[model samples]
Target: MDTIPAILRAAAERYGDQPAYVEGARAVSFAELHDQVRELARRYVGHGLAAGEPVVVWGPNSIEWVIAALATTYAGGTLVPANSRYTGHEVADLVDRTGATVVMVADGFLGRSQVQELRAASDLPSVRAMGELSRLSLDHRGEERHVREVTIDEVEARADAVSPDDVADILFTSGTTGRPKGAMSAHRQSIGVARAWAELGGVSADDRYLVVNPFFHSFGYKIGILVGLLTGATLYPVATFDVDQTMQLIESERITLLPGAPTIYQSLLTAPGRAERDLSSLRLAVTGAAVVPVVLIERMRDELAIDHVVTAFGMTEAVVVTMCRDGDSAETVATTCGRAIPGMETRIDAPAGEAGELLVRGDYVMLGYLDDPAATAEAIDADGWLHTGDVGVLDDEGNLRITDRLKDMYISGGFNVYPAEVEQALMRMDGIQDVAVVGVPDERMGEVGKAYVVGTASADEVIAFARQRLANFKVPRLVETVEALPRNLSGKVLKNELRK
Candidate 1:
């Protein structure tokens, strides 16, 4: 499909009665999805929201969140999804940055009212809770045509007014170093990546997708929701990724497809009474963000009975650059993020066999950072390559091994040390459940690796374990065991936080 609105229309016509999304006790069919989106779009129009305006959809996983997203697009507005886990200050920053005209937030999530939080943080207009909107929609029910007089043809016409090049979304990047910049993507680019990802994963109508990724992430909103629509797979949105609840959902829902970060599958593998649950229906799986243990991949297949376990690499600016294919070996799946998606091209800026910055250019590349011309120019050069601030190497077979973030690499004893490489080595260490390595200040070697692990291990023991497999320069000087590592909504460890 060309646009999200187009996908809605197409799915409504093709899979009219098939279930589209299921959240808790609520389930919506493809036809109902379209009707709800259309009705909501009319309400948005009735409220005087114009085309190309920005609307903030701030909430966790729910059918209403999905409807707000699609309705925003159908109303010819750009959807700016806010991370529900954000504090008031963070949410205020996004609302101010995006200049969102309307805020549709979940009421009292985590015992805090999102609308109250937004109001407390900033002076925003048209803030309405989801329950308020539901009541309003109910009050305006038979008067849908009379209130706005917007017919289905008129809604379609409004959706048709949105061009392929129009900015459909402004996804804020995880602000690890500085403030998060809004990465703007046109309808075509946003839809293109999801379509490619679905094809890469072999998503089919028969599949049932369990989306544990938060709705604010590109992985969840685009790949999870959009791919489900594209492939006609039933979507089950998990508001939280609790191991017990997630396993129960897979068993109860007969989930067939699940894709999340490495931590997700790792937790599922180690969950108590995991084998007692019936996860045999799981067929396709994808994980990334951290190094995937080879044994973990093997166990997922053998123990969980999952058929295809794929690994992929991408970012907010560009989605799905590389992905492991269906029949790739376990080592291949664990070690390398397989070749680029169909039409995307990736090249390392440094010498061959050496890790360097990875650059990508394709239809999937974003339009640019919203309202920041200088930053946009710095990110995407005149040659059209989007300079991904990541260090990686491409093997002869075209598979990509991401060493670390370019900013995460440090020079030690005149040699570069990538934390991801060191972290990968530490992941194989016995008694270590998860690991994050960061370069820390050192008096002699200029810099040294400091590892934060999620298991019981003494610093000396962990250093010895690393010394066995990694070079002297790569071995972590200090290993701190913690209950858990700090991570963002997408399951990426916050190394900056760790450095603190």
Candidate 2:
């Protein structure tokens, strides 16, 4: 009950014969997954790695991804999952920052990108490919079998001797700053988050989940994977986010639950044969990351036909605070981030209709930013409330409305301009897929607005469109058309990288 391993134990007892995980054509049962983790723990302990040391789970979403994670935790080590979409140097910078003791990457990860980083990494740790580990399926095939030279008896013997509360994972923050910050999470934190999500989402064993998002993100780990496990539900993992592929998988898998950015939902609306497909099985669709526009939410309501589209707002610091509740209004669902979840407190420094920096405090807030006391002090106040850098306003009912990001706001000619406002206006233009607005230095204006747009329209056309919607001062002075926007693994826009 205190850890995820306990839930694994429960599944082995009540649902051992049930299908626990299915990857493409391969399926592993409850007992099968538990046994696999047990052996994985032995393999890690067999190596010289000790508790609290870091082991990187670097790969596309796979059964092995979960296995490596569980095994690392079961062996009492910290797991660090690398973002598969990131460049090698990007990945190396993260690993180097965490100072991992060992890294588990898929074969040919280096060949995929210039992230030949881990190999050239100075003061590097041990590395392993998937097949190199002698751990087997821990299958109960009615007869004893050997996994390489090792037996199931050997694996179980090693697992039975371990303890919980050993550092389970060192989840490094998506490094917006040059150096990534590692958040040391325990087995208890995983369980706590999953439990909190179950209450927030009302998830159950009957729910069938479809997750296209990567597990490294807080939403995927806490809600997609962790909540699914807690509810005894079946989870369908899509390694990558392909709008067309997800549409088909939803029907094929009979998906009932989903949690991802509004981008996924936006893209799904355009999937071919979208209206032709039978998608009646879906019940819950949770979106986070960027704010959900009312138009997108309306299209989802009238088009995709999913009624209960819940939106929750949170960060790695505060687990999850605001979530639009059941029977909440479309305007509320689309605009106002709903009332605070149980055990969470929310406040706005400005008047009800005015914007202010959002503050959240709860049992789920992270202990502190790992090793950076100054940043920890700056982020979390003496009262223990985490000051989320997000800028938003509180409505009469205490629901929060996020207008723009504090960091993304800029000053132009002594006038304040929020890039989110400009980006939102540009996104409404025809053929526009995405748009990002930033501020660059201007001798006269201090900072001038610049827009990077991704769409079929030319720079002049976009500028023309923006000129009509915004004031002359607010209109972007520079427009660069790009194929796409740079985003982090969680689908959050990497504005820091975009600025560079």
Candidate 3:
């Protein structure tokens, strides 16, 4: 059961009547989920979706999103997820690059029509069909007017045709140095990584997972959705992270497994009326994405009463590289992302305890970047190790501690913010001569972007200009004007000086 569909089938046989997914008023058992996914896969095949084709799913975290994404793979099509916060212009670039034939959007999310936004952004000549994700009902008996009708046998045939080595997803991750590149992962790699994470966390069928991370990310998709499929754990998806709502869900759902960025725990620790909330049900807590203070990890165990609090480090290319164990000390969990999981190897380029570029090679590393051979070659060397642009060191105990980043990228509320991308977007504004963006410390969001501009445009005007072009998280939160940006002999902006 190396493939997702195979794992799903196994889950159905093992956990049949158990609740697999619970959304608001709807709940689907493992057996029912399998049937629904197959039915939707039939719809995809009926619409002439060829094997190995790409389908883009642009929506928030929901049962419909889960079904649609799995159905794409079940129909032998590649799943390309679009960030819900991405503007239409951004999504259009991805759809065009992937040559996606179909796009399913969550229209009217956050008060914007996703379909209309993509339409206005580009004609999307490669896209042959577009469907609203909200209309995709899991009920097999309900009417679905979007896709063509096909037989269950046809869907089963398509699923059988899909091999474990075939491409399952092409997740687009922004490069700190350049444009976003689609990291391709096969079915085996995706399922393998999820299985590793589930095993490390000791995830079980009875554990209720509260997923606050967006489904588009590997954290929520591979670890959140696929982990449930492999372990039979029931998943409760949270589209947005409202502290009050999340606390309420934890108590009401009796969630046992909760994994998210450090900010989520910070919010919960300081959230209003938190003492009254019964959070004793929480057992396993995994957090990462930004620096985790030792105090935060200690507080989570003390105040929240969670038994296991661990941390992990991962990227788009390799989903689960290193993770802390169940009984790891609070200081160890806070300072280091634990040893590499089984079937993976890690090494620092410098001497033993010294910080250097961290390199990883494993069974779960991405095959390569989609249609970008040059970039792919540069990333993964001939030796087969992927050069992760992060600076870290390995302690004597084999724990990997990330000290610095080679790339000027930061995490804001668990979202990767590449400074180069923000700088490029800021340059588009008129009267802007030069700009340098740096990640500044923020208590709420792990880090926020602050732009240093050497231009005539006012800070307010520059920020306003970026708001329309980039996503809210990508936009710079603060702006400062300088006479000129400091540059080195090689003409690279000295971001360190700007940070000072």
Best candidate per lDDT, number?
A: 3
1 versus 2: better TM-score goes to:
1
Cα-based lDDT at residue 126, candidate 1: 38
**Candidate 3 wrongly placed segments (more than 4 Å):** 137-149
The ten-residue window of minimal lDDT in model 2 covers 133-142
Task: Please give, for residues 1-500, the per-residue lDDT of candidate 2 as tens digits.
Answer: 65556666676677676766777788877788788887776666555445666777666666777777777665656777766555454466666666665566654542453224445544344332223212322221112322244455655544444444544556655322324566665666666776876776778877778877677666666666667667777777777667777878788888888777676776677777888887888878887666567887788777877868877777766667888888888889888878888778897656767888888887677766667888778877999778777789887787888876666766554334667767776888997889888888764455788888887888888889876555455678888888888998998788777778
Give stretches of model 2 more than 4 Å off.
Answer: 109-117, 123-166, 174-177, 351-353, 409-500
lDDT of 3 at 91: 92
Taking the tens digit of each residue's C-alpha lDDT, what string does model 1 give over 1-500?
58889988898898999999988887899999999899888877766567988888777887888988899999899999877666565677777887776667676776766666666777754332122333324222222333345667777889988888889999986423335688999998888999999998889889999988878888899998889778899999887668999999999999999888766777788899997999999999998766667998999999989999999988888967899999999999999999999868999999989999999988888888888898889899999999988889999999999887756766554344667767766777778899888888774455678899898777888999776555466678887889999999999998889888
Give candidate 2's root-mean-square deviation (CA, Å).
10.8
Candidate 3 achieves a global lDDT of: 0.90
Candidate 1: misplaced stretches above 4 Å? 125-152, 175-177, 409-500
Between candidates 1 and 2, name the one with more favorable lDDT.
1
Please, what's the RMSD in Å of model 3? Answer: 2.8
Model 3 poorest ten-residue lDDT run? 137-146
